[model samples]
Target: MLEKNHILTPEKWVKLHADYLYNYTISRINNHEISKDLVQETFFAALNAMKNFEGKASERTWLIAILKRKIIDYYRKINSIKGKAEVRMNFYDDGEHAGEWIEERVPSSWVSEVEKDIENRELGNALEKCISALPEKYEIVFRMKTIEELETEEICKELDISSSNLWVIIHRARLQLRKCMEDNWFKK
Candidate 1:
Protein backbone atom coordinates (compact mmCIF):
# COMPACT_ATOMS: atom_id res chain seq x y z
CA MET A 1 0.00 0.00 0.00
CA LEU A 2 1.94 2.96 -1.30
CA GLU A 3 0.77 6.53 -1.27
CA LYS A 4 1.07 8.08 -4.70
CA ASN A 5 1.81 11.52 -3.26
CA HIS A 6 4.62 10.24 -1.10
CA ILE A 7 6.31 7.97 -3.58
CA LEU A 8 9.61 9.61 -4.50
CA THR A 9 11.66 9.05 -7.60
CA PRO A 10 15.46 8.61 -7.30
CA GLU A 11 16.23 11.54 -9.58
CA LYS A 12 13.94 13.79 -7.60
CA TRP A 13 15.50 12.69 -4.33
CA VAL A 14 19.02 13.36 -5.61
CA LYS A 15 18.06 16.75 -6.90
CA LEU A 16 16.33 17.75 -3.68
CA HIS A 17 18.56 16.18 -1.04
CA ALA A 18 22.03 15.56 -2.36
CA ASP A 19 23.57 18.88 -1.28
CA TYR A 20 21.67 19.06 1.99
CA LEU A 21 22.71 15.54 2.96
CA TYR A 22 26.32 16.20 2.01
CA ASN A 23 26.42 19.37 4.07
CA TYR A 24 24.79 17.68 7.04
CA THR A 25 27.26 14.82 6.98
CA ILE A 26 30.31 16.94 6.36
CA SER A 27 29.42 19.24 9.23
CA ARG A 28 29.42 16.32 11.61
CA ILE A 29 32.32 14.32 10.19
CA ASN A 30 34.49 17.25 8.95
CA ASN A 31 35.65 15.20 5.97
CA HIS A 32 34.60 15.87 2.41
CA GLU A 33 35.63 12.50 0.91
CA ILE A 34 34.01 10.38 3.61
CA SER A 35 30.87 12.54 3.63
CA LYS A 36 30.53 12.07 -0.11
CA ASP A 37 30.91 8.31 0.23
CA LEU A 38 28.39 8.14 3.07
CA VAL A 39 25.86 10.23 1.12
CA GLN A 40 26.26 7.95 -1.88
CA GLU A 41 25.86 4.91 0.33
CA THR A 42 22.77 6.42 1.91
CA PHE A 43 21.17 6.83 -1.48
CA PHE A 44 21.91 3.23 -2.43
CA ALA A 45 20.51 1.94 0.85
CA ALA A 46 17.40 4.06 0.52
CA LEU A 47 16.91 2.90 -3.03
CA ASN A 48 17.12 -0.72 -1.94
CA ALA A 49 14.76 -0.22 1.00
CA MET A 50 12.19 1.80 -0.94
CA LYS A 51 9.65 -0.98 -0.87
CA ASN A 52 9.59 -0.91 2.93
CA PHE A 53 9.11 2.84 3.05
CA GLU A 54 5.99 3.40 5.10
CA GLY A 55 5.75 7.03 3.98
CA LYS A 56 5.09 8.12 7.52
CA ALA A 57 8.15 10.35 7.58
CA SER A 58 9.41 12.67 4.91
CA GLU A 59 11.82 11.13 2.40
CA ARG A 60 14.62 13.39 3.62
CA THR A 61 14.06 12.29 7.20
CA TRP A 62 14.19 8.64 6.23
CA LEU A 63 17.38 9.11 4.24
CA ILE A 64 19.00 11.07 7.07
CA ALA A 65 18.17 8.27 9.49
CA ILE A 66 19.95 5.78 7.25
CA LEU A 67 22.92 8.12 6.87
CA LYS A 68 23.15 8.57 10.61
CA ARG A 69 23.27 4.82 11.12
CA LYS A 70 25.97 4.57 8.46
CA ILE A 71 28.05 7.18 10.31
CA ILE A 72 27.66 5.33 13.60
CA ASP A 73 28.67 2.08 11.92
CA TYR A 74 31.74 3.79 10.56
CA TYR A 75 32.72 5.03 14.02
CA ARG A 76 32.05 1.60 15.56
CA LYS A 77 34.27 -0.10 13.02
CA ILE A 78 37.07 2.39 13.73
CA ASN A 79 36.77 1.94 17.51
CA SER A 80 36.86 -1.84 17.21
CA ILE A 81 40.08 -1.72 15.22
CA LYS A 82 41.62 0.87 17.55
CA GLY A 83 40.60 -1.15 20.61
CA LYS A 84 42.55 -4.11 19.34
CA ALA A 85 45.58 -1.97 18.60
CA GLU A 86 45.37 -0.28 22.00
CA VAL A 87 45.45 -3.65 23.74
CA ARG A 88 48.56 -4.66 21.87
CA MET A 89 50.36 -1.39 22.53
CA ASN A 90 49.46 -1.03 26.20
CA PHE A 91 50.07 -4.61 27.31
CA TYR A 92 53.23 -6.24 28.50
CA ASP A 93 55.13 -8.94 26.65
CA ASP A 94 53.38 -11.79 28.56
CA GLY A 95 50.02 -10.79 27.01
CA GLU A 96 48.29 -12.06 30.15
CA HIS A 97 47.88 -8.59 31.65
CA ALA A 98 46.24 -6.49 28.98
CA GLY A 99 44.25 -3.33 29.66
CA GLU A 100 46.16 -2.58 32.85
CA TRP A 101 47.55 0.93 33.22
CA ILE A 102 51.31 0.91 33.40
CA GLU A 103 53.08 2.30 36.46
CA GLU A 104 54.53 5.20 34.53
CA ARG A 105 51.22 6.04 32.96
CA VAL A 106 49.34 6.14 36.27
CA PRO A 107 47.73 9.56 36.76
CA SER A 108 47.86 11.54 39.95
CA SER A 109 44.70 12.81 41.65
CA TRP A 110 43.71 16.39 40.74
CA VAL A 111 40.00 16.33 41.58
CA SER A 112 40.38 18.38 44.78
CA GLU A 113 42.35 21.11 43.07
CA VAL A 114 40.11 21.02 40.02
CA GLU A 115 37.07 21.43 42.27
CA LYS A 116 38.65 24.47 43.88
CA ASP A 117 39.36 25.95 40.48
CA ILE A 118 36.13 24.90 38.85
CA GLU A 119 35.13 28.49 38.07
CA ASN A 120 38.39 29.26 36.30
CA ARG A 121 37.84 29.90 32.59
CA GLU A 122 41.34 28.64 31.84
CA LEU A 123 40.40 25.29 33.34
CA GLY A 124 37.48 24.98 30.93
CA ASN A 125 39.68 25.86 28.00
CA ALA A 126 42.27 23.33 29.13
CA LEU A 127 39.60 20.68 29.43
CA GLU A 128 38.41 21.39 25.91
CA LYS A 129 41.94 21.14 24.60
CA CYS A 130 42.46 17.84 26.40
CA ILE A 131 39.25 16.37 25.03
CA SER A 132 40.10 17.48 21.53
CA ALA A 133 43.54 15.90 21.88
CA LEU A 134 42.07 12.45 22.49
CA PRO A 135 41.97 9.97 19.66
CA GLU A 136 38.82 10.22 17.58
CA LYS A 137 37.30 6.99 18.90
CA TYR A 138 37.85 7.77 22.57
CA GLU A 139 36.83 11.40 22.12
CA ILE A 140 33.51 10.39 20.53
CA VAL A 141 32.67 7.94 23.27
CA PHE A 142 33.71 10.30 26.04
CA ARG A 143 31.75 13.22 24.60
CA MET A 144 28.66 11.09 24.07
CA LYS A 145 28.69 9.58 27.54
CA THR A 146 30.00 12.51 29.56
CA ILE A 147 29.27 15.75 27.73
CA GLU A 148 26.14 14.62 25.86
CA GLU A 149 24.80 12.71 28.90
CA LEU A 150 23.99 9.67 26.84
CA GLU A 151 23.34 6.43 28.74
CA THR A 152 25.70 3.49 28.72
CA GLU A 153 23.27 1.25 26.89
CA GLU A 154 22.56 3.96 24.34
CA ILE A 155 26.28 4.51 23.77
CA CYS A 156 26.92 0.78 23.49
CA LYS A 157 24.10 0.40 20.98
CA GLU A 158 25.19 3.41 18.96
CA LEU A 159 28.85 2.39 18.93
CA ASP A 160 28.09 -1.33 18.60
CA ILE A 161 30.35 -2.09 21.58
CA SER A 162 30.00 -4.29 24.64
CA SER A 163 29.39 -2.87 28.12
CA SER A 164 32.86 -3.91 29.25
CA ASN A 165 34.44 -2.28 26.21
CA LEU A 166 32.52 0.91 26.81
CA TRP A 167 33.71 1.02 30.41
CA VAL A 168 37.28 0.40 29.33
CA ILE A 169 37.20 3.13 26.73
CA ILE A 170 35.65 5.61 29.12
CA HIS A 171 38.18 4.76 31.80
CA ARG A 172 41.08 5.29 29.43
CA ALA A 173 39.61 8.50 28.11
CA ARG A 174 39.15 9.87 31.61
CA LEU A 175 42.66 8.91 32.59
CA GLN A 176 44.09 10.63 29.55
CA LEU A 177 42.04 13.73 30.16
CA ARG A 178 43.03 13.85 33.80
CA LYS A 179 46.67 13.54 32.91
CA CYS A 180 46.33 16.21 30.29
CA MET A 181 44.56 18.64 32.60
CA GLU A 182 47.13 18.05 35.33
CA ASP A 183 50.02 18.77 33.01
CA ASN A 184 48.55 21.70 31.15
CA TRP A 185 46.33 23.42 33.71
CA PHE A 186 47.03 22.27 37.24
CA LYS A 187 50.79 22.71 37.07
CA LYS A 188 50.55 26.00 35.30
Candidate 2:
Protein backbone atom coordinates (compact mmCIF):
# COMPACT_ATOMS: atom_id res chain seq x y z
CA MET A 1 0.00 0.00 0.00
CA LEU A 2 2.75 2.46 0.83
CA GLU A 3 4.70 1.72 -2.33
CA LYS A 4 1.75 1.73 -4.68
CA ASN A 5 0.37 5.05 -3.34
CA HIS A 6 3.22 7.09 -2.00
CA ILE A 7 1.80 10.54 -2.25
CA LEU A 8 2.15 11.48 1.40
CA THR A 9 4.81 14.14 1.90
CA PRO A 10 3.45 16.45 4.57
CA GLU A 11 6.79 17.64 5.91
CA LYS A 12 7.98 18.80 2.53
CA TRP A 13 4.87 20.92 2.26
CA VAL A 14 4.70 22.31 5.78
CA LYS A 15 7.41 24.93 5.35
CA LEU A 16 5.83 26.14 2.17
CA HIS A 17 2.58 26.75 4.03
CA ALA A 18 3.80 27.98 7.42
CA ASP A 19 4.02 31.58 6.33
CA TYR A 20 0.54 31.29 4.90
CA LEU A 21 -0.85 29.86 8.10
CA TYR A 22 0.96 32.43 10.17
CA ASN A 23 -0.43 35.37 8.24
CA TYR A 24 -3.97 34.01 8.00
CA THR A 25 -4.34 33.49 11.72
CA ILE A 26 -2.48 36.62 12.78
CA SER A 27 -4.11 38.98 10.33
CA ARG A 28 -7.63 37.68 10.73
CA ILE A 29 -7.89 37.02 14.41
CA ASN A 30 -5.11 39.19 15.85
CA ASN A 31 -4.16 36.44 18.30
CA HIS A 32 -0.51 35.39 18.23
CA GLU A 33 -0.72 32.51 20.65
CA ILE A 34 -3.71 30.96 18.89
CA SER A 35 -2.15 31.60 15.49
CA LYS A 36 1.03 29.80 16.50
CA ASP A 37 -0.95 26.86 17.83
CA LEU A 38 -3.12 26.78 14.73
CA VAL A 39 -0.07 26.65 12.47
CA GLN A 40 1.15 23.59 14.30
CA GLU A 41 -2.27 21.98 14.23
CA THR A 42 -2.56 22.49 10.48
CA PHE A 43 0.67 20.65 9.78
CA PHE A 44 -0.22 17.79 12.09
CA ALA A 45 -3.69 17.45 10.64
CA ALA A 46 -2.25 17.37 7.15
CA LEU A 47 0.26 14.74 8.13
CA ASN A 48 -2.21 12.48 9.92
CA ALA A 49 -4.66 12.60 7.02
CA MET A 50 -2.21 12.74 4.15
CA LYS A 51 -3.74 9.74 2.48
CA ASN A 52 -7.10 11.44 2.32
CA PHE A 53 -5.84 14.64 0.76
CA GLU A 54 -7.55 15.36 -2.52
CA GLY A 55 -5.49 17.01 -5.25
CA LYS A 56 -8.37 19.12 -6.54
CA ALA A 57 -6.78 22.36 -5.32
CA SER A 58 -3.15 23.34 -4.82
CA GLU A 59 -1.53 21.80 -1.77
CA ARG A 60 -1.21 25.15 -0.05
CA THR A 61 -4.87 25.86 -0.67
CA TRP A 62 -5.92 22.55 0.84
CA LEU A 63 -3.80 23.13 3.92
CA ILE A 64 -5.25 26.59 4.32
CA ALA A 65 -8.80 25.26 4.19
CA ILE A 66 -7.98 22.81 6.91
CA LEU A 67 -6.38 25.50 9.04
CA LYS A 68 -9.39 27.79 8.73
CA ARG A 69 -11.73 25.09 9.97
CA LYS A 70 -9.44 24.50 12.87
CA ILE A 71 -9.59 28.17 13.81
CA ILE A 72 -13.42 28.20 13.84
CA ASP A 73 -13.54 25.10 15.97
CA TYR A 74 -11.11 26.70 18.37
CA TYR A 75 -13.20 29.86 18.67
CA ARG A 76 -16.46 27.95 19.06
CA LYS A 77 -14.99 25.72 21.70
CA ILE A 78 -13.61 28.64 23.65
CA ASN A 79 -16.44 31.12 23.19
CA SER A 80 -19.38 28.73 23.47
CA ILE A 81 -19.96 29.99 26.98
CA LYS A 82 -21.45 33.17 25.51
CA GLY A 83 -23.62 31.27 23.02
CA LYS A 84 -23.44 34.01 20.45
CA ALA A 85 -24.90 33.15 17.07
CA GLU A 86 -22.45 32.54 14.27
CA VAL A 87 -22.75 35.04 11.47
CA ARG A 88 -21.13 35.55 8.13
CA MET A 89 -17.93 37.63 8.16
CA ASN A 90 -18.10 40.22 10.91
CA PHE A 91 -17.43 43.53 9.14
CA TYR A 92 -16.31 46.70 10.88
CA ASP A 93 -18.53 49.69 10.44
CA ASP A 94 -17.09 52.29 8.10
CA GLY A 95 -16.18 55.57 9.77
CA GLU A 96 -19.16 57.59 10.97
CA HIS A 97 -18.32 60.51 8.67
CA ALA A 98 -19.86 58.38 5.91
CA GLY A 99 -18.02 59.62 2.83
CA GLU A 100 -16.64 56.89 0.58
CA TRP A 101 -13.15 55.83 1.49
CA ILE A 102 -10.55 58.04 -0.13
CA GLU A 103 -7.26 57.09 -1.67
CA GLU A 104 -4.14 57.54 0.46
CA ARG A 105 -1.64 60.24 -0.28
CA VAL A 106 1.56 59.43 -2.13
CA PRO A 107 4.60 61.65 -2.50
CA SER A 108 5.61 62.30 -6.09
CA SER A 109 9.32 62.88 -5.41
CA TRP A 110 9.99 59.90 -3.13
CA VAL A 111 8.29 57.08 -5.02
CA SER A 112 11.38 55.66 -6.67
CA GLU A 113 13.60 56.13 -3.62
CA VAL A 114 11.00 54.57 -1.34
CA GLU A 115 10.52 51.63 -3.66
CA LYS A 116 14.26 51.01 -3.67
CA ASP A 117 14.40 51.25 0.11
CA ILE A 118 11.61 48.74 0.47
CA GLU A 119 13.37 46.37 -1.90
CA ASN A 120 16.59 46.68 0.06
CA ARG A 121 16.25 47.11 3.86
CA GLU A 122 14.56 50.06 5.50
CA LEU A 123 11.08 49.31 4.24
CA GLY A 124 11.46 45.66 5.09
CA ASN A 125 12.39 46.43 8.68
CA ALA A 126 9.47 48.78 9.03
CA LEU A 127 7.09 46.20 7.63
CA GLU A 128 8.44 43.57 9.98
CA LYS A 129 7.98 45.82 12.98
CA CYS A 130 4.48 46.78 11.94
CA ILE A 131 3.43 43.19 11.36
CA SER A 132 4.91 42.12 14.65
CA ALA A 133 2.92 44.79 16.43
CA LEU A 134 -0.40 43.52 15.09
CA PRO A 135 -2.53 41.18 17.22
CA GLU A 136 -1.41 37.60 16.71
CA LYS A 137 -4.44 36.24 14.86
CA TYR A 138 -4.71 39.06 12.36
CA GLU A 139 -1.01 38.90 11.64
CA ILE A 140 -1.11 35.21 10.89
CA VAL A 141 -4.19 35.38 8.71
CA PHE A 142 -3.01 38.36 6.70
CA ARG A 143 0.43 36.87 6.22
CA MET A 144 -1.00 33.57 5.03
CA LYS A 145 -3.63 34.93 2.67
CA THR A 146 -1.87 38.00 1.34
CA ILE A 147 1.85 37.21 1.50
CA GLU A 148 1.52 33.42 1.20
CA GLU A 149 -1.38 33.49 -1.26
CA LEU A 150 -3.85 30.91 0.10
CA GLU A 151 -7.50 31.01 -0.92
CA THR A 152 -10.19 31.97 1.59
CA GLU A 153 -11.80 28.51 1.65
CA GLU A 154 -8.44 26.90 2.24
CA ILE A 155 -7.72 29.28 5.10
CA CYS A 156 -11.15 28.71 6.61
CA LYS A 157 -10.70 24.96 6.61
CA GLU A 158 -7.18 25.09 7.97
CA LEU A 159 -8.23 27.40 10.79
CA ASP A 160 -11.74 26.05 11.38
CA ILE A 161 -13.30 29.47 11.07
CA SER A 162 -16.50 30.61 9.35
CA SER A 163 -16.37 32.51 6.07
CA SER A 164 -18.01 35.46 7.75
CA ASN A 165 -15.36 35.51 10.42
CA LEU A 166 -12.65 35.14 7.83
CA TRP A 167 -13.94 38.06 5.81
CA VAL A 168 -14.18 40.33 8.80
CA ILE A 169 -10.74 39.37 9.97
CA ILE A 170 -9.27 39.92 6.53
CA HIS A 171 -10.88 43.34 6.20
CA ARG A 172 -9.67 44.43 9.58
CA ALA A 173 -6.18 43.12 8.97
CA ARG A 174 -5.89 44.98 5.71
CA LEU A 175 -7.15 48.17 7.29
CA GLN A 176 -4.65 47.88 10.10
CA LEU A 177 -1.76 47.15 7.77
CA ARG A 178 -2.72 49.99 5.52
CA LYS A 179 -2.76 52.38 8.42
CA CYS A 180 0.52 51.09 9.73
CA MET A 181 2.25 51.27 6.38
CA GLU A 182 0.92 54.74 5.76
CA ASP A 183 2.08 56.01 9.07
CA ASN A 184 5.44 54.30 9.29
CA TRP A 185 6.59 53.83 5.72
CA PHE A 186 4.83 56.41 3.67
CA LYS A 187 4.68 59.60 5.69
CA LYS A 188 8.05 59.66 7.35
Candidate 3:
Protein backbone atom coordinates (compact mmCIF):
# COMPACT_ATOMS: atom_id res chain seq x y z
CA MET A 1 0.00 0.00 0.00
CA LEU A 2 2.92 2.34 0.66
CA GLU A 3 5.17 1.58 -2.25
CA LYS A 4 5.51 4.49 -4.71
CA ASN A 5 6.24 2.65 -7.97
CA HIS A 6 5.37 -0.91 -7.18
CA ILE A 7 3.86 -3.13 -9.83
CA LEU A 8 0.49 -4.67 -9.10
CA THR A 9 0.59 -8.18 -7.72
CA PRO A 10 -1.51 -10.88 -9.33
CA GLU A 11 -3.52 -11.34 -6.16
CA LYS A 12 -4.18 -7.63 -6.05
CA TRP A 13 -5.26 -7.66 -9.66
CA VAL A 14 -7.69 -10.52 -9.07
CA LYS A 15 -9.21 -8.85 -6.03
CA LEU A 16 -9.52 -5.49 -7.72
CA HIS A 17 -10.21 -5.96 -11.40
CA ALA A 18 -11.83 -9.36 -11.82
CA ASP A 19 -15.34 -8.08 -11.29
CA TYR A 20 -14.73 -5.15 -13.63
CA LEU A 21 -13.48 -7.48 -16.33
CA TYR A 22 -16.41 -9.84 -15.81
CA ASN A 23 -18.92 -7.03 -16.13
CA TYR A 24 -17.19 -5.59 -19.19
CA THR A 25 -17.11 -8.98 -20.88
CA ILE A 26 -20.67 -10.01 -19.98
CA SER A 27 -21.98 -6.77 -21.42
CA ARG A 28 -20.48 -7.75 -24.77
CA ILE A 29 -20.85 -11.56 -24.74
CA ASN A 30 -24.05 -12.14 -22.70
CA ASN A 31 -22.80 -15.54 -21.57
CA HIS A 32 -21.75 -16.09 -18.00
CA GLU A 33 -19.63 -19.19 -18.52
CA ILE A 34 -17.79 -17.86 -21.53
CA SER A 35 -17.25 -14.49 -19.89
CA LYS A 36 -15.74 -16.16 -16.86
CA ASP A 37 -13.47 -18.27 -19.02
CA LEU A 38 -12.28 -15.22 -20.94
CA VAL A 39 -11.56 -13.32 -17.77
CA GLN A 40 -9.54 -16.23 -16.42
CA GLU A 41 -7.73 -16.53 -19.69
CA THR A 42 -6.96 -12.83 -19.57
CA PHE A 43 -5.34 -13.24 -16.20
CA PHE A 44 -3.26 -16.18 -17.35
CA ALA A 45 -2.17 -14.38 -20.48
CA ALA A 46 -1.30 -11.25 -18.55
CA LEU A 47 0.72 -13.29 -16.07
CA ASN A 48 2.64 -15.08 -18.76
CA ALA A 49 3.30 -11.92 -20.65
CA MET A 50 4.09 -9.74 -17.67
CA LYS A 51 7.68 -9.55 -18.74
CA ASN A 52 6.70 -7.68 -21.88
CA PHE A 53 4.29 -5.28 -20.22
CA GLU A 54 5.91 -1.89 -20.67
CA GLY A 55 3.60 -0.10 -18.23
CA LYS A 56 2.64 2.56 -20.72
CA ALA A 57 -0.98 1.62 -20.06
CA SER A 58 -2.67 0.93 -16.79
CA GLU A 59 -2.89 -2.65 -15.67
CA ARG A 60 -6.62 -2.74 -16.24
CA THR A 61 -6.23 -1.45 -19.78
CA TRP A 62 -3.64 -4.09 -20.54
CA LEU A 63 -5.75 -6.90 -19.17
CA ILE A 64 -8.87 -5.67 -20.93
CA ALA A 65 -6.99 -5.46 -24.24
CA ILE A 66 -5.93 -9.06 -23.85
CA LEU A 67 -9.45 -10.06 -22.90
CA LYS A 68 -10.82 -8.30 -25.98
CA ARG A 69 -8.48 -10.27 -28.24
CA LYS A 70 -9.45 -13.49 -26.47
CA ILE A 71 -13.10 -12.74 -27.07
CA ILE A 72 -12.40 -12.07 -30.75
CA ASP A 73 -10.52 -15.34 -31.03
CA TYR A 74 -13.38 -17.19 -29.38
CA TYR A 75 -15.83 -15.69 -31.85
CA ARG A 76 -13.55 -16.58 -34.75
CA LYS A 77 -13.20 -20.17 -33.59
CA ILE A 78 -16.95 -20.62 -33.18
CA ASN A 79 -17.65 -18.87 -36.46
CA SER A 80 -15.19 -21.05 -38.32
CA ILE A 81 -16.93 -24.16 -37.08
CA LYS A 82 -20.63 -23.22 -37.30
CA GLY A 83 -20.92 -19.91 -39.16
CA LYS A 84 -21.09 -21.23 -42.73
CA ALA A 85 -23.62 -23.89 -41.86
CA GLU A 86 -25.84 -21.51 -39.94
CA VAL A 87 -25.59 -18.83 -42.62
CA ARG A 88 -26.62 -21.34 -45.23
CA MET A 89 -29.55 -22.57 -43.22
CA ASN A 90 -30.78 -19.24 -41.95
CA PHE A 91 -30.10 -16.68 -44.66
CA TYR A 92 -29.84 -18.80 -47.79
CA ASP A 93 -32.85 -21.07 -47.41
CA ASP A 94 -34.33 -19.75 -50.65
CA GLY A 95 -32.76 -21.34 -53.73
CA GLU A 96 -32.34 -18.22 -55.84
CA HIS A 97 -32.44 -15.39 -53.29
CA ALA A 98 -29.58 -16.14 -50.99
CA GLY A 99 -28.92 -13.46 -48.30
CA GLU A 100 -32.01 -11.46 -49.16
CA TRP A 101 -34.67 -11.02 -46.50
CA ILE A 102 -38.04 -12.57 -47.30
CA GLU A 103 -40.94 -10.19 -47.80
CA GLU A 104 -42.62 -11.23 -44.57
CA ARG A 105 -39.44 -10.85 -42.56
CA VAL A 106 -38.31 -7.49 -43.91
CA PRO A 107 -37.92 -4.81 -41.26
CA SER A 108 -40.03 -1.70 -41.22
CA SER A 109 -38.39 1.71 -41.15
CA TRP A 110 -37.99 3.14 -37.66
CA VAL A 111 -35.13 5.60 -38.06
CA SER A 112 -37.09 8.65 -36.90
CA GLU A 113 -38.76 6.80 -34.04
CA VAL A 114 -35.40 5.27 -33.12
CA GLU A 115 -33.94 8.73 -32.54
CA LYS A 116 -36.66 9.51 -30.01
CA ASP A 117 -36.54 6.06 -28.44
CA ILE A 118 -32.79 6.21 -27.97
CA GLU A 119 -33.35 8.23 -24.83
CA ASN A 120 -35.76 5.69 -23.40
CA ARG A 121 -34.37 3.26 -20.84
CA GLU A 122 -36.80 0.52 -21.84
CA LEU A 123 -35.72 0.85 -25.44
CA GLY A 124 -32.10 0.52 -24.36
CA ASN A 125 -32.87 -2.70 -22.55
CA ALA A 126 -34.71 -4.08 -25.56
CA LEU A 127 -31.82 -3.09 -27.79
CA GLU A 128 -29.40 -4.96 -25.56
CA LYS A 129 -31.58 -8.03 -25.69
CA CYS A 130 -31.87 -7.87 -29.46
CA ILE A 131 -28.14 -7.44 -29.94
CA SER A 132 -27.54 -10.36 -27.61
CA ALA A 133 -29.86 -12.51 -29.70
CA LEU A 134 -27.75 -12.06 -32.84
CA PRO A 135 -25.40 -14.82 -33.98
CA GLU A 136 -22.00 -14.68 -32.31
CA LYS A 137 -20.02 -13.39 -35.29
CA TYR A 138 -22.63 -10.82 -36.14
CA GLU A 139 -22.98 -9.75 -32.56
CA ILE A 140 -19.24 -9.38 -32.15
CA VAL A 141 -18.80 -7.39 -35.31
CA PHE A 142 -21.87 -5.28 -34.67
CA ARG A 143 -20.81 -4.38 -31.18
CA MET A 144 -17.24 -3.67 -32.16
CA LYS A 145 -18.09 -1.38 -35.04
CA THR A 146 -21.29 0.22 -33.80
CA ILE A 147 -21.62 0.47 -30.05
CA GLU A 148 -17.89 0.33 -29.36
CA GLU A 149 -17.35 2.76 -32.23
CA LEU A 150 -14.20 1.08 -33.37
CA GLU A 151 -12.91 1.97 -36.81
CA THR A 152 -13.95 -0.45 -39.54
CA GLU A 153 -10.34 -1.15 -40.38
CA GLU A 154 -9.57 -1.87 -36.73
CA ILE A 155 -12.49 -4.27 -36.50
CA CYS A 156 -11.43 -5.97 -39.72
CA LYS A 157 -7.90 -6.35 -38.44
CA GLU A 158 -9.00 -7.60 -35.05
CA LEU A 159 -11.45 -10.13 -36.47
CA ASP A 160 -9.19 -11.11 -39.36
CA ILE A 161 -11.96 -10.38 -41.85
CA SER A 162 -12.14 -8.28 -44.98
CA SER A 163 -13.89 -4.91 -45.15
CA SER A 164 -16.67 -6.24 -47.36
CA ASN A 165 -17.22 -9.17 -45.04
CA LEU A 166 -17.43 -6.79 -42.08
CA TRP A 167 -19.98 -4.66 -43.90
CA VAL A 168 -22.08 -7.70 -44.78
CA ILE A 169 -22.03 -9.01 -41.25
CA ILE A 170 -22.99 -5.57 -39.93
CA HIS A 171 -25.78 -5.31 -42.48
CA ARG A 172 -27.18 -8.67 -41.43
CA ALA A 173 -26.84 -7.82 -37.78
CA ARG A 174 -28.72 -4.58 -38.25
CA LEU A 175 -31.50 -6.36 -40.11
CA GLN A 176 -31.88 -8.96 -37.40
CA LEU A 177 -31.77 -6.33 -34.67
CA ARG A 178 -34.40 -4.28 -36.48
CA LYS A 179 -36.70 -7.25 -36.74
CA CYS A 180 -36.13 -8.19 -33.13
CA MET A 181 -36.87 -4.69 -31.89
CA GLU A 182 -40.00 -4.49 -34.01
CA ASP A 183 -41.33 -7.74 -32.60
CA ASN A 184 -40.26 -7.18 -29.02
CA TRP A 185 -40.39 -3.42 -28.39
CA PHE A 186 -42.34 -1.61 -31.12
CA LYS A 187 -45.14 -4.11 -31.49
CA LYS A 188 -45.83 -4.00 -27.82
Candidate whose lDDT is highest: 3
Error of 1 at 152 (Å): 1.5
- Each model's TM-score? 0.66, 0.48, 0.69
lDDT of 2 by residue, 57-98 (tens): 677777887886787777566545442432222232377634
Clashes of each: 0, 60, 0
Candidate 3: stretches off by over 4 Å: 1-8, 50-65, 83-101, 107-120
Instruction: Determine which window of 10 residues in candidate 1 has minimal summed lDDT.
Output: 84-93
- Residue 98 CA error for candidate 2 (Å)? 3.3
**Per-residue lDDT tens digits of candidate 1, residues 1-188?**
96544665788877899999998766545558988998999999999999998877788888988888998988967766744434223324456666566666665665455567989887788888988787777877788788778799987876678999989888878877877877888766
Which structure is stronger by lDDT: 1 or 2?
Answer: 1
Please list the residue runs of candidate 1 whose C-alpha ends up more than 4 Å from where it truly belongs after superposition.
1-44, 47-52, 80-101, 109-113
Q: State the displacement of the C-alpha of residue 108, model 3, in Å, after optimal TM-score superposition.
A: 5.1
Candidates in order have lDDT scores of 0.78, 0.68, 0.80
Candidate that scores best on TM-score: 3
